[model samples]
Target: LEVRQCLNHMTDIFDLIDAGVSPGRFDLAREKLKKKFGEDAAILRMLEGDARWIELWIAVANTVKHPKKTERIVVNDLRLLPDRRIQLPTWQLFHSTRCLDAPQALLESADIVIQNLLGLFENLFVVVIDQVLPALPSGLQWVLDDIPEAERDPKCPQRYLLSIGMRNARHA
Candidate 1:
């Protein structure tokens, strides 16, 4: 029941956010989306962390609703193009999406909020892994380490912070 209400609220909020996004008002849209997704995720976790139906339905619904886009950012294969047509790397694209260019004030506030959030979770991941290690099998023992580094679990908050800055570096 709680999960249902949360999902319905998230759906409505996302709709309003989509309607709000545009070239001129992208910052506003991003702020709203960031807040909505952050709160919604935490609430969703609390409400339905054990619901198999919600899990299956969300996975199916994600696939149906957001058809994946295979974006290719390759440099011009045509030999006629200039250097300005240079391929924009994924990291660059990710950084550019941030509101850093908006203003200095916005950037400072963002830094403060991010720092505070980090402080709230300081080293808790280490504790979680330590607690789980004894209960896990030797074969599956790598789950703790692999989990911290592997493909971001969509439902995880740590995965959310795996930035584009570290993404390519990690692969390299």
Candidate 2:
């Protein structure tokens, strides 16, 4: 659920940039991104590539929020471990216990989805910042300085910083 929220927040920031608003609370960033960039955009393409996991996460979040209207898609069964303590399989995002003929593959798939989502966010943020930077006021430009070192990649120092600073301020 937290992961989903993080993704949604990132989407919102992307939308805020697209709209050229001063980065306040706004709604429907994900929808805005899709509408503005279209499905063919690279960032959108990356997200579509992991659509299965995103769909499952949405279903799981809905089930959690409105259990009466949605069914839980993931479950774990407890088992006795060799150490005499009980253990449970990783929580999975599908209704079944197994996927692709393997037990607990759903968790792995979900992890991949999360990783993809993070990458997509990074890519989308870069794209949006590039589009919006020219129009931003000079005083507001200092916000770029807050970008973390990791994202300030030497190969693309100017491109990767915008998203990281905005993310740190919001998520910190």
lDDT of 1 by residue, 78-150 (tens): 2333755633221111121121222233344335544433432333233223333344333332322323536
Per-residue alpha-carbon lDDT of candidate 2 for residues 1-172, written as tens digits (9 for 90 to 100): 7656765565565544554222321234434557887767765565556556555555566566756422444556777879998664655433332222234544565677666666656666665656666554433332443456667667654433332333225433
Report lDDT (CA) for all predictions: 0.34, 0.53
Return the TM-score for each candidate structure: 0.21, 0.52
Question: How many residue pairs clash in each candidate at the backbone level?
Answer: 0, 0
Q: Which ten residues in a row have the lowest lDDT in candidate 1?
A: 90-99
Off by over 4 Å in 1: 1-107, 119-122, 145-157, 160-172
TM-score of candidate 2 on Cα atoms, chains taken together: 0.52
